[model samples]
Target chain A: MDLQTSKAPSPKLPHTALDRVVPHSESDWNDAAAPAAERHALIKSEAAGVQLNLGELWHYRELLYFLTLRDIKVRYKQTLMGVAWVIIQPLLTVLIFTLVFNRFVRLETGSLPYPLFALSGLLLWLFFANAVTNSTHSLVSNANLITKVYFPRMFIPAASVGAGLVDLSVAFLLLVALCFYYGVALTLQILLLPIFVLMMALLALGVGLFAAAVTVKYRDLRHALPFIIQLWMFASPVIYPTSVVPQKWKWLVTINPVAGIIEGFRAAITGQHFDWIHIFISLVITLAVLASAIYVFRRFEDTFADVV
Target chain B: MNTAIKINQVSKRYRIGGLHPGYMTFREMLGGLVTAPFRKLKSGNGSQTLWALSDINLEIGQGELVGIIGHNGAGKSTLLKILSRVTKPTTGEVELFGRIGSLLEVGTGFHPDLTGRENIFLSGAILGMRRKEIERKFDEIVAFSELEKFIETSVKWYSSGMYVRLAFSVAAHLEPEILMMDEVLAVGDAAFQHKCLDKMNAIRQQGRTILFVSHDMAAITRLCRRVVLLENGVVSFDGEAREVVKRYLSSSLKTGALKEWTNQHDAPGDQVARLRRVRVRTSDGVTTAVVDIRQPFGIEIAYDVLAEGHALVPVVEFYNEEGTELFSTHDTSSNWRRQPRPPGTYTSTVQIPGNLLAEGSLVGHVSIMSHFPATVLHAQERNAVAFQVVDGPAGDSARGDYIGPMPGVIRPLLQWTTETNELSPKSNVQSPTSAGNS
Candidate 1:
């Protein structure tokens, strides 16, 4: 390496836009009881990294927001009606599902207008699918960056979820409008909408991180993901109401936690009833999957640059 | 002084065949796999594992900018990946104090459909920059990128130059404390590249430690004080930038003359004059050669004139790493002679000078052809011997009047002009003046 650059004057003076006010030194990092070499690097890594430092990432959280915003704008760029696509997308999906299921299949929506019920589930699915797909391809496709530079591996998957959140928010408005059109009165249970959103986001992030790591090593997953996600949508109760599911098979529904979340959406928005059984089961499943995802993501994160 | 980044005994390995070209029927391929377990394990071409970097130990002090350079597959990229934490090292460790900002790629996370302004924030965020900072530098970055007019257009519509320009602008403008740039210079044209260098130079002024990589030797020589040379994932040389480039280029010279063998080896299209030994010698016809200062030297290529031909012209060309053709010479006058030495051993020697060529590796491209009805008997796009030209007395322009670095690859001996006034003319011009002093 021609280090004449070391002799090159410091970066254009007034180096203000750094991550931390107190620049961390290599020596200071070394003092931590991390592995001398690989272990040391692992220490700082988000997983098996020496330690997880939320404060450091928080300092640069603005970057995360910018990335999320970038993703949102990029999705709608060039196509007609930029931000409108966010709302139009779910609106169309709701229309299609309502036509196919409510009008044709005639699935009972349990006192809830079918359009409002379908959209509620659609909104959550969009976030999860987009997040998982983006995260799966993030490390491999960003070869230029991942191979060239390093950052927290989780950031890529997390940013995808964050970016998709903007779309989800815009799409959620349609669900609200549909509820109003159907004259479903607001209830205190609506406050719990955020908890479902968080659960969905976490679920998406966890699966997305796992997919991103696996795709780096197994290219087959790259090809398999879209089909798997499409199939996964069917497994979740997006197109139909969970009430029709036989009580005996309800346990199988818990296998796909989105089923529980979708049922919760129906319960919260319609103010009919809560599926505490499915919701509790869904939360547990989401946590198990998330912990495993983090563990797998961290395990594979170290090797990402090489494979990617 | 605190060390900003410390890497010790780091290594990275990759499985080859990410891109394999082959054909296999679906059923048979699966059947072979299924049966392989029953029969002796027939290892179908096992994947090759190559280590991109190994046993690298270095300490980067706080706010130290380092430039890394190496030949293709020399593990420079691998090292950068490890430093940036993009990939885990198979062994060894890296300890870093401050958050590292790596521009591993310009517009790495850019969504093509995204508008320039949006991509900026997105790419900026991916690089670990805050939205507010991206906003603060938004105008400046746009101005620097020279894409102010089309800021809202999707980046997919932007030309490659515009994309690179905007990408680099965002990366550098975002201002990470520790920055890593990899071949970022390869994207822009000459003027743009110069502009980028100046911008990078400006960025360096902020005391942010940086790591830059490029293929242009001149730029590398000018920008980097120290360079690391990697050979097979190991540091071969780590010191002065000039010396490392010199070492890398010099090693390219041929260690021995081309060997001669008349045995029946498959020759390209039998029409080619069977080549024997290609040698270098002095103008005096001495076999051994090294031209003294201001002395001339020649290259002697011996071959058997396998077939009769007319208008045969031999040419030699030299090139630098940047694909710049430094010089080429074709002996047109000799081709006109057409004195056929048919079916016999013949020697052709072209004389130039050892001192004339600049101090660098000069590889020769040789072509043999018959130009009667105009036919190329044998032509190799890239061929022949490489030699190193040692510096003599002349010096280069960038570092003037030195005992080294003669200007521009060739220091040809040439005549010069000076004017001295005639005695009678001087007397007439000074007639009204100093005559009385004599």
Candidate 2:
């Protein structure tokens, strides 16, 4: 109630047309009176549901790049292997799969060599696995940045995916080497490799978005995430081929979006028969998951700073 | 005037004490999800709502610098957070014009593993700067940080001071139409803090609207022309910076004079002792705001000792109006010094003799400690009691007849004696003549 109207002396500067001699109050803020060149930003609380503010995201794209770069640069900072870890991780996983599934269990991998088949699937699977794991904890890990500055929160998760893509590209080199070592011939179907990689990336991003948002509220996801990823890897056809599954149970495997992508990737790399029905089903499920993940991510984005 | 920022009826509500803790476990979440309907039917509402800010309305004009001053949890940071878009309010809206760069904390996005140079670009981008802008200002930022020799070195090797310098330099170079800063000056050394203030002054001179939130009254008064004082999530006063700061200081003094603990669970103490009541009173046992400088005053600290056979020492610290610690006095009474205190409620009074303190507001801090085992029974309650010391009548107090502001925290009335000699005139004349001859 103690509102003293004694205005402080204004600074001596060149006055613009917007300058006024009157006092500032709630009633004096007329949006129509402001010039068109003057940009205005409004802040509010009740932003419910999913609003993909693409413009805001686009504006902060540079920040996303820097964040992704930071993640990659810091990922291997003190490690002895550095970028070698990216290649070594998937290569080692493929070796273990070939040993356990091919040598011991003797799982059928169609006509393709077991190492070539498993490496192709393992390469994409590692990308998706690392991407989802990193993106799920991205917001919480950067809680300082989220609470201190104003940027699109989606950039944190998206940058995790972007950084994962860098690792994926590096690991892809190892896959090419493995294909040559196994004498697997590349066919025209290999041209569809980028599209399938994009689909797998989207599937990872969708799950990452959902997990990131949920982790902000329920930190239990942080503890349960590795277990979930372990289960998801077995659910996909990374260790074995999708063709070995029984016909009735094949529908259950296709429900996982990564299943068909892995199978399609192996086909593209080793020159096997491409399954159009499986690819189509995987693409549709990936799109649905991506759309809903984005929706859920945007819905929970407003509460991230508060709860995080 | 053209408004730079308009906040209308913005209220933020935070829920308290629900079945769900701040963090949720998978089992608890699953169980809650299953019984949510049943729990909803049984309990009307399981959580209580606290409005951190409620119905706050304000408008800041273009090129205006405003300081926000408040106690902790008075919603000062909340307002800054809402304006900066770091968090959203629960009700109403806020409109901001022009580009806004908010520095809520120093070194916000700094990655220790990254080099100082890499962190500069990363922090710059995090603060909404374009890569081109950072590239342009790269040398200037490095120069300002004074870490040119260590720019390529990882930030983890840099000292905390160097880290703050680099982080602040990047943020300082950010050119925004509107800037919001919250107590970022509290870090770094005093010299660096002055440099930051100089940079802030330069920013102010550019006709950019600035919203500064700080507890340092001197900085607030020096930088901001207008001040908004918030108390209990509402604008308590809005006026010139000096006047509002004075009001805030006096109000804090008034509130710090007395504290009572009705609940033992909520009292300030450890297992050994707990404070029951703390009061500033006159020698006659009357609680008053003003204490005459010629008369003694007392700080009555009533505490209950929860444990027996513990040597508890009561220490009281006095601070001036400027938050400068005047002095600290400890209870060395023979009774407690010789024997351990038994478990019982006890009242201890520390007396401030006349002519010992300057004529200004003095804040008292009370603490209880044990020495042999080196334990603090009760952490010091800073500003537990505050009282003003006014000058007494002329010829009776430390000030004597002078009616002006004293220089130091303590003005002791020391006695002086003068003796006149008959040879003093001759000596003075001889001394002047010898000096003139030389």
Candidate 3:
């Protein structure tokens, strides 16, 4: 090691003598000092508390838009069905539910036609399910970008959630057409559909933030994520009405945020009484999950580049 | 002058091969929960960690183009990552005064299914350009890439050269206040590389700060006024670019100038010949790790000639600092050219003339060939020995009165003649008259 270190300085034989003559001019030292005091950004190993840099996120909102656009474009490109798959996916699922639950199980949907009831539920459920699944894999899928550039890591999972909105809107159109075909009367309550959809998106994004962060550390989630989403669908009242739950267990079913949104979607479009208690519970739960998810996501954010 | 970037006591620690899985399954998490107490009792720290970077401190003034050079795994990329905020440092802090654009990789966020035009926008946005900014520079980026014809074609269908050209063009057109690059220019052909360098030079002239990391010594020397040499996760030296590069090359070559094969069976060779040792030495036959530009040097290759009646030609190829082959020479002795060598160990020496090589490191690739039958290579060793050629007193050498780095691979002292002939009075007087008549 000593010999190696000794050899290092000798290679610059021509400049060694000259370098001693002029170590560094005062102008050069002053130049380096002048700009350092006015630095706009300071990155430290540990940030202060759990505060997320919302300002930075706001500055990079355009990147969020572009990333979301890329996901939507890439998802449809080269597919035979293209944008039609977004509609077909839920319609087919709704058909299966109407056949299996309405026809075979003879499930009651509180006077609403089974197809109308199932399509509305399926639209929101599919968006939530797809958002959760896609956002879980978002960070790992964009590992190339994560390792190469710096942006708010939140954008990856957020983009996944945003991209799913495009699909949700397309599927919602089909649901509206199905309601008209079934002669379902639209009411003032139906104006609240966007709020329910927003809640569902927030719920998905909340869970997705946690899952995406975890997926960076443990990749087994990548495979198990779809299975989790499938199980979560059964847990939520996507196919059946919450009224079908045993009177004693109704409280348990309403704890699922999706149940309230899906149930609210049915009541909204079919002119049923709005369930404020259940909607309020779902909003509280969604906000709680989203808050904690952001906390955990930011906590693990620094390690994503290393772990991924 | 303002400071563009400042790093203070930064360090990065990475977990080495350990059971700490980065991606875990539900089963593993459940299992970990079940055995949490036992695991904690058995091992204090779950995994072994290696510090990739340790206590790095650096400051760059506004408009300064600094180069960071190091051997692989010396934490050059880790430092860049910390600077670019791709990953947080384990300790200390970094500050930047201006909008930073990092090209750790060309086309980093490019989707293969997206067309060239779409990718230009996508990549530009990923690198922190606004949509309007991309729209404004879109045509210039396309022209720079020379990919007008393929702009509508998906990048998946693009040849790799086209992909790199378009990616680099987008990155080159990014007019950030501070730019960080990591070996992205190593892609593409030589001409494209020069174009990129020229673009970087223009960027520097605009008074923007730049941080460049590359293994290409020539590029670093040409583009960077200052260089920081990282060794084993720490800054070993930081000074003038030429001086730092020279230190880096020599330190890297400390063990590279000599290689000995203690075990014959494990040596690099075929059945016909095997290498014993290779060394670079001064004219006095004393082995030296570096050579003086004004002094002659010798490359000594010792090998065993295992078979009889086989003529062997020892060839030495000299490559400049950029890894471009300057020239190749073979020992064409009258004895070896006419006759076959008896089976024995033979030492081949090739002398490099003084003042022939430029003042930089020259890497010699040693190979022995059987030229008589089919010109088959019996044994070859790449980078067998590397020796630095430092500039001696310039008066007697070709670099007379020049204080800057020389340009080419070879700088030779050759004779020159100049003559001045005064025109005859008769011809001089007739020239004006003839021109006026015409």
Per-candidate DockQ values are: 0.21, 0.27, 0.29
**Once model 2 is optimally superposed onto the true structure by TM-score, how far is the C-alpha of residue A115 displaced, in angstroms?**
0.6
**lDDT of residue A184 for candidate 1:** 84
Residue B399 CA error for candidate 1 (Å)? Answer: 3.8
The docking quality of candidate 2, as DockQ, is: 0.27
Provide the RMSD of all predictions against the true structure, rounded to 1 decimal.
10.1, 13.1, 10.2
The digit string of per-residue lDDT tens for model 2 on B43-132 reads: 664255677898899999989989999999899999999999988888889999887889999988999999999999999999977787
True contacts kept of each: 0.32, 0.69, 0.64
Q: What residue runs in model 3 are displaced by over 4 Å at the alpha carbon?
A: A1-39, A47-49, B31-47, B254-361, B364-385, B388-438
- Across B1-438, the per-residue lDDT of candidate 3 in tens digits comes to 788898999988887764664555677789999998897788666256778899999999999999999999999999999988898988889989887778898788899999999899889988877787689668878977889999999999999889988888888766667888899778777655655665666567668799999987756765677899999999999998767876787677654667789988888788888888899887788776666667899999999888887788888999976889999999898877947878788899999898898876778899988877778898998888887776633357776633434578798878754332333647745232332343
Instruction: Specify the highest-DockQ model's number.
Output: 3
**In model 1, what lDDT does residue B309 have?**
51
User: What TM-score results for chain B in every one of the models?
Assistant: 0.59, 0.61, 0.68
Query: What is the descending DockQ order?
Result: 3, 2, 1
- Give the alpha carbon lDDT tens digit for every residue of A1-308 in model 3: 34433444434424322222121233322334323322368888954345577777877788989899999999999999899999889878888888899889999877788888788878888888889988998999899888889888998999999999988887778978987888877889889888988999999999999999998987887888788888878887888777667888877777988888888877888888888999999999999999999999999998888889
Candidate lDDT scores, in order, read: 0.67, 0.80, 0.81
Of the candidates numbered 1 and 3, which has the greater TM-score value? Answer: 3
